[model samples]
Target: MDQDGRDQNFSAASQVNGDHVEVVVTGEVDMSTADALFRAATPDGVHCATLDLSAVTFFDSAAIHAVIRLADRYPGALEVRPSPQVLRVLEISGLAGQPWLKPPS
Candidate 1:
């Protein structure tokens, strides 16, 4: 828990496994909440970060940018599990084929 809960529209829960960290993200992810997600993922010290966006109901470009920036900030260290809707956004934004995004398995 950080500051005012209502101010941050997204929430994250993290679990570490070996050299990876699974970060489950819930709620909307937009300009207003992207920073929170960034802060949450930046601290785990795990080389690999998996963002479970299955629970995410909404995602904006800012959110996508946040993910991309984090991936760029730590190349080969970020992965995203975006739902079909979110994936569509990423694809439309020309970021779908990036190696940081793991194919659903």
Candidate 2:
């Protein structure tokens, strides 16, 4: 959680389900916090990664770029759960149709 009473800041916590890892992220993801986001998503021994950003309140281009880079680095191993805000950014950036960024149901 952040001092400003926002949803937890850009941090990742994980749980293992059989062979997969689900990384739930909450809070804002921006230029200043992209490294943390990247590191959290690319932990060791993770064969499958899901980034859940439903609680995220904000996202910037840096976050989007980081997501793209991470996906490119890991290819089929990465899944992104972007919040509506994050999804909007991807849609505006022309990245919504990317294979790694599936629309929320």
Candidate 3:
């Protein structure tokens, strides 16, 4: 929590599956917390990765930039599954249609 009494909950955890890695992210994501997101999104020696933002409640452009950086690290191997909140932002930013995003089922 910050001085504003808002729930500043933020967390990112990674799981390794063979050469692939899956990063699950949750909570509010803003500029102040984007760096940590980038760090958690990048796992060494993992060519393929999945960023599951389906639990995120809030996010901003900083999160978009973080995803971009992660794309740089993993290239074509990064997949992002965005929550409704995140999906709205990504759609607004024109990133929702990017190849890094997991196609809707």
lDDT by residue (tens digit), candidate 3, 1-105: 688744469888888887888888899888877887887766677778898888989899888889888888888888899888888898889887789887457
TM-score of each: 0.82, 0.81, 0.86
Give per-residue CA lDDT, model 1, range 20-46, as digits (tens): 778899888888788878877776556
Ranking by lDDT: 3, 1, 2
Q: What stretches of model 3 exceed 4 Å from their correct place? A: 2-8
Task: Output the number of the TM-score-best candidate.
Answer: 3
RMSD of each: 3.0, 3.2, 2.6
TM-score of 3: 0.86
Q: With candidate 1 superimposed using the best TM-score fit, by how many Å does residue 1's alpha carbon deviate from the native? A: 16
Q: What lDDT does each candidate get?
A: 0.80, 0.78, 0.83
The per-candidate count of clashes, in order, stands at 0, 0, 0
* Whole-model alpha-carbon lDDT for candidate 1: 0.80
Model 2 CA deviation exceeding 4 Å by range? 1-8, 16-19
Clashing pairs in 2: none
Q: Per-residue lDDT for 16-100 in model 2, tens only?
A: 7765677787878887777677877776766777888888889998888888888886789778878899899889999888777
